[model samples]
Target: MSNGDGSAVRSYHDRTKHSPASVRASRHALDWANQPLAFKIYETLEPIALPRELPPIDVPALEAIARIESSTANECVPDLPTLTQLLYYSAGITRRITHPGGEIYYRAAACTGALYHIDLYLVCGDLPALAAGVYHFGPQDRALRRLRPGDHRRTLIEATGDEAATAAAPVILVCASTYWRNAWKYQARAYRHCFWDAGTLLANLLAVAAARTVPARVVAGFVDRAVERLLDLDPGREAAIALVPLGHTRDRPGPAPDAPPLGLRTVPLSAHEVDYPAICAAHLASSLETPEQVRAWHGQTPRPVAPAPTGPLTPLTPLLGATAPRDAIDRVILRRGSTREFGRVPIGLAAFATTLERATRGVPADFLDPPGASLNDLYLIVNAVDGLRAGAYVFHRERAALELLQEGDFRRDAGYLGLGQDIPADASADVFLLADLAPVLARYGDRGYRAAALEAGIIGGKLYLAAYAHRLGASGLTFFDDDVTSFFSPHAREKSVLFLVALGMSARRAQVVPSA
Candidate 1:
């Protein structure tokens, strides 16, 4: 039951690694008839419709993705319309394609298998055109369904162990994932997708918030059970993943109302539910049980052991501050989609370098001490990037350069490492985030697993936006975890692979807007 026991998380990660023999030996199949519902339906709760006509966030997408911290220092309480805009661009349905079987609803962010398992909820004090309450965002209807009535920000403040942003903010957005919705395709591994999918969505959220100059901070360390009780989430199915407090405020919350169960009924996700004990067990293994634990867990960023590179180095030319592409963030997010097939073409070294530099700048999270530290290291498989040799390399984030690990055509190796997928082979580059979890788990315990995975997801999400900012394409892919570490060995020795992203020109542009 101790969250500090990291072996539980390690065991789960080892069991889920996909190998050539393991993939071929698998017997998993999708059940189209029993597919889980995309939206969490509360049939009894009346929908409070959000504004339809939302304003465009005109900040250039590149600039927005480059900066993780909100620009504003002054107190800024967002109006209802601002909230609507935030929600729309973050998780709203952007477009849909009608098919003979059904319509495929495309969202603002990319998700593995297009499962749309991640959900958003808002907890706020009374604001213009909105009442004080806890509300679940129903993306299907573009509405908020009230779950608790009254100011509940104090509950989150306590849940986060009095995180500075949570204590000062007037509103908090809770990100949660319903396992079966994604588990239907990924099975037990869907637990990892919980953070991966949510991280992509958060990239959009943080960008939109920055575009509007709203103060926001990502609080990942929290008393898990308290927040679950406050939100009334079913421990077996849906669980809160991260908390983002938006728009600073001077006034403190007086107190919180009781969070007794309302026993609200929800429409079943599918015709039948199959339990995945591994998912629940892994979650429980890393969960924080008390505010004291959460308090002790925050602000302890581990210094991952990495020696100075012995290989050749290539300095990155990232577009410095204020000189970036002007594609509006809202537009970029709307146009974003997971590129399926790479064009097998070369992209500018600058474009690829910008993604690495900007995405790894730093994330504004409670788990990151001094605000700029990170738990993951960036390793790359370069296949077709212009002005960069075709080879494998490791990113020297501090020096803003790449250290060549090996020089050769790695397309064949990339394909094999990415679970034998063609995307990584054809893409201009593939980024694999590796973390030495011995130090991470030692510093933060099993909860360090959550920190590492969440940070990987957030950076992968940023990489997605950074690629799209330059009109390139990007997609997150699963990899042979141990193989990835082996490929970047010596430097990446003893490190665990947290996430992988493929970047390049799409073979053909994905349909951002469906044709009539």
Candidate 2:
């Protein structure tokens, strides 16, 4: 497998899959004393404090999540206060938990192992309060530290091949991941976590942008080396994953000034870090090198047309009228947390249907073809839901219905598929996101893996918000990859599992600690 071929990604996927037998055969143990720090710190740079005093948006969570386009005109630009609120609610540290050894700072979105590996950066022209520059977001201090002293939005525009969204945007945010931060726990599979964690953050960002009626779009196609150079990142250690254009403006940026080397100082993540060659190889194989390749990658691919519904289909009954929850976007995010324990309580059918319908409507992304078509299929193991049968079902987004596949109680099977976890067994339903990787890789090359995982994470994030808004609980869980596919065999025999989310009522409420 080489950098130019898609076979590398397929080989990497096959090599990293987890199974019951494989788990016992491998002897990997946690290095507790050598754990890497979760946050990146710039030792020499002075932090320009961001305004902590901010007001919450009044848009309802459901209304915000359901919005695919902004109602306000695209000429509106986001001011400093609005930007502050967006960054705070998207990735800021919202809660802290104390234990005997130390304290843990939980962030706005859920991450695998709570290892906050993803970092956000801002690139913008002169705004109301902020100067024209490139800056890194320091969630640790709730501040922004300037990395470059002038407008660099044109650099991103050129790298993205003058993408429509980038051409007309006033502000753009770059999301990157530090491999060692998450690899310390997840090992080689940390590559997948890069997109998952970033997608969760984007989920929050898109919803908030819509609530404020700001135009935004997620750009996944870009020249990898150009972005790394602009961010001053070591491609091997830290790599850019996605670019998001914030608010739209009619004014286009001029040619960017020369980007020179700035050897800045930063605190190390740990005393020593371990390297995973497989992770690096996979990333390299999927990287796009030229503007032409980026443009070609953006071309739409024909998705397999869905066959007419022949199986028994149950139309979804989403709560749309007066019964929908009116919680604000900020309040929903602050209250969002992974459910540690799910009580065996059946949720209302309308609530369940609404969550599924609203979350899968579509994501404003570059990789998805025809704008609204999804790369992954939704599969469910229904344990409890009012007016729904206890069995397995596959969601047909085109028809907005669930096609019954198997009819029987499989709570124990669900638990086993989720790596022997009790959450899936006790939850009302376990939503499994699976994708047919063959066509995806064939169309977009190895980068499709990132797109598939990211789509899952975004939808999973929306599910978390939906559950919380409706007064339910949801948690993103890991599962045995092959087992998940096998459990939904025949219907999903050729597909691969991308992500899982368990939804139900929480047995105990989580405590929220104020930020320090």
Candidate 3:
């Protein structure tokens, strides 16, 4: 709830942590009849239907994004077709499956509940093939609906205190979460989901932008009220979470139009939605009130180190080189979907090794441990990895091999750890990321929550990329907090699980191909 006001909030370590009984106790057994939806619909503005025609892009362009090769902001500008391709590949529904229950649609990224709540809004200057305007990306239809017809990039620049990326971007992408979409299943935890879910989606968006040779950067600090008004969203329900400045333009943007409120209407997503108090409370706490406040939160000093590695250190040896003849990130994304059914089989140790090597090769971020260091530790329950013994092990970044802690099949344990999800139990291995949080919270305060979640997502995103590269399957998973810490305890005693990813062979091929 604390958006980022330098509040000395207690980390998850300091909380009067919930016991199994306490977790259930804190869980408000919602009365289904009384469930309240999360989005606050304004009865005025008409629903603007999006365009249905989205052209296809080449795989090489997509690969450029995943590899961050498209990050150079020079003279390149995104045309209308490129914009459409980015949005469609980032969050559009790629596959629809008919089940006994009904039809279930899968999106571009793997979200916790598959509760697609995050929305994309575009602000830009006039460009070739498209008029200059503020627009909303409709994932369902793979199109853009014009909201305000003019350049509004200057408003964002002012909101971000003229952050270099925001100031120079030709078009900016805004991500907002409608609380109810996820809260329907997760309730209060939806607040955390807002970032986690959004982060995963951004992972795809960022990579896609890179593929298009469009330079983009994530901006988390901005004047909250100013952005909320510019998009005319109800901060209580649908609030902006992050921004991405897409491509570059030589011409400086002029002043933004006075953001007069336009109350928009939309169809209800579900029958009902339940509100979570803790989530909303946490969101409010971190919100920035002014541009000055946002400016103050921009930079962070490098973390001080204590000691060097003492454990067996092994450097990663990925199967494919950075320039391997792999499918482009765009092609991989169009084909990616979370594995709902994993086959119980031993994944080649080399395959597992390659994934770790490629995914952990550091992401571009200012808040990381250092240039090559990461804040979290990768621990695993090796249910099955060919040529590797079944065991509990810690991945030493310096040493690419598993430092075995204990050996045995913990398939059932893995199932329980994943909050009873069958995916982890059946997967060859489940990679659990744990971090020492005392220093993290002390350094960044409540904002550390954002860092931990974001870092986990970037790596998880890389895992998705790496797994696909290896002809394997992977899915981001959720778990019982304490149970996970306890599973990797003694060694992981002081550490906490930040994120989980299950990797193995999938039982069925459900990859989607976007309509041309």
C-alpha positional error of residue 155 in candidate 3 after TM-score superposition, expressed in Å: 1.7
Candidate 2 segments whose C-alpha is farther than 4 A from its true place: 1-5, 509-516
lDDT of 3 by residue, 1-516 (tens): 345433433332234233466566775665555444322343443445444565544554224433543545367788877877778777788888999976777788878767678888999888877678888876655556777878888888998878877787888999888887777766655766777777777777777776666877777777777888888887777778888888877778877777788766666655655565555556666666767766766666334353354444334455554544367676687677787788777777666777787667665443553445566778998887777778787887766656777778899999988878799999889999887766676655566666666667767877776677666789888788888888886778866677899998887532232111
**1 versus 3: better TM-score goes to:** 1
For every model shown, what is its TM-score relative to the native structure? 0.97, 0.96, 0.86
The clash tally of candidate 2 reads 0
lDDT of each residue in 1-516, candidate 1, tens digit only: 858568999999899888877889989999889999999989799999999988778788877776768754678999988999888888999998999987989999888889999999999999989999999999999999999999999999998889899999989999999999999999999998998888888888888888888887888889888888888899988789999999998899989988798779999999998889999999999999888988988866889556988999999998766666788899999898898898877888877788888888788899888878999999999998888999999998999999999999999999999988899999989999998999888888888888888889889988999899988899899998888999999888899998999998888743342211
Q: Name the TM-score of candidate 2.
A: 0.96
- Between the candidate structures 1 and 3, which one is better when assessed by lDDT? 1
Per-residue lDDT of model 2, residues 1-516, tens digit only: 322546888888888888899888878888998899888888888888989888868888988887776643638778988898888888899988899988989799888999999999999999999999999999989999998988899999988888888888899999999999999988898888888888888889889999998887888889888999998988889889999998888898888978897878788888899999998899889888888888888868547675565667889978885678889999999989999898777777888999998888888888876768788899999998888899999999888899988989999999999989999999989999998988888888888887888888898888888888987899998889999999898888888998899998887632232111
Best by lDDT: 1
Model 1: residues with Cα > 4 Å off, grouped in runs: 321-323, 509-516
Cα-based RMSD of the predictions, in order?
2.9, 3.4, 4.6
lDDT ranking from best candidate downward? 1, 2, 3
> What is the lDDT of every predicted structure here?
0.88, 0.87, 0.71
Error of 1 at 259 (Å): 1.6
Between the candidate structures 2 and 3, which one is better when assessed by TM-score? 2
Better by TM-score, candidate 2 or 1: 1
